[model samples]
Target: MGLYHFAKSLVYGLLKPVYRMEVIGTENFPKDGGVLLCSNHIDNLDPPMVGITAPRTIHFMAKEELFEVPVLGKILPNINAFPVKRGMSDREALRKGLKVLKEGNVLGLFPEGTRSKSGELGKGMAGAGFFALRSDAYVVPCAIIGPYKAFTKLKVVYGQPIDMGPIRERKASAEETTELIMAEIGKLIEVHR
Candidate 1:
């Protein structure tokens, strides 16, 4: 926990001024337990931007390419960020995410898979759904209002965690589960937009 705060302060100290972040709905964020912080991607800095806003430590899953860098590879892991293979069925990524949740840490995910080109939100993929089912972690839906630009008011609105009661009771199929998760995330994002 100390490491997390130290790393967060280091990052925020260096970048917060350059971004001039304006956070909202921070009161809605839970302060404990395993949580899934889902957000829309706008730029490479999106993960750090979203993660830093959480009062608790929030680790994010980034692309495997980031790990290839010499200095960053060493440092990113220390800050609780790791890489994932793109265009592959990354069970390893999913497992890592589940592990993070099971460890009672926050797992930050960009369900859109990549950054938004038109600065418009994309339909969320099933990665979030898989993580939810595997670990029983609550999904805390988030939205970033102005990440395309820099040093501006980029709002992060956190919606209430989802309820999977009926879906689990119904024994929802994978597709059903994925769609359900996607819909809930979409609805949350829409609320703040």
Candidate 2:
């Protein structure tokens, strides 16, 4: 297997029993074509957790600072992660994300931009919406509900793909599309949490 799949398998083996992870609604995930997998971030472990559980390989946009770290810097790209300059409009990162989707790959995003310290859902960023609209990919909303304490139940719920047809038809603003995405994520959180 490739590095990404190998790492995913390793992580899954280790975390499944430790977190007692329960994943629901994975059926909602499309098996083919490009996908924009958007989720609410709560902890640093969120990205890997989501990646391993997802049926398809997910290329994540990690913060640029992470790439400066010692070993992790060299490892991130091998595992399908690329750096994005946070707290600014980084055009290069956006282009990279679009490229990933355009090639029929799953591009995972945390719409909140950063992990929430209080574990509360935060505002959705326009970048995710931009990707969704631009790529015309399946926009899948996901929620990771967790305290992450050892042996505790951590649930990852994948909600149905958001219907982007209307939004595309109306040529809605990215912010508006982001609102719809966040609303769907909120609903998933409500039902699962």
lDDT of each: 0.76, 0.94
Assess every candidate by TM-score.
0.87, 0.98
Candidate 1: where is the Cα deviation over 4 Å?
A: 1-3, 148-151, 174-178
Ten residues in sequence with the least summed lDDT for candidate 1? 174-183
Best by TM-score: 2
Model 2 poorest 10 in a row by lDDT:
127-136
Q: Quote model 1's TM-score.
A: 0.87
Model 2 Cα lDDT, one tens digit per residue, 1-81: 999999999999988889989999999999999999999999999999999889899999999999999999999999999
* lDDT of the structure predicted as candidate 2: 0.94
Q: Which pairs of residues clash in candidate 2, taking residues 3 or more apart in a chain or in different chains?
A: none
User: lDDT tens digits, residues 74-147, model 1?
Assistant: 88788888788877778888788889999888899888889889877776677877777667677777777775
Query: Measured by TM-score, how close is model 2 to the native structure?
Result: 0.98
Q: What is the lDDT of residue 117 in candidate 2?
A: 91
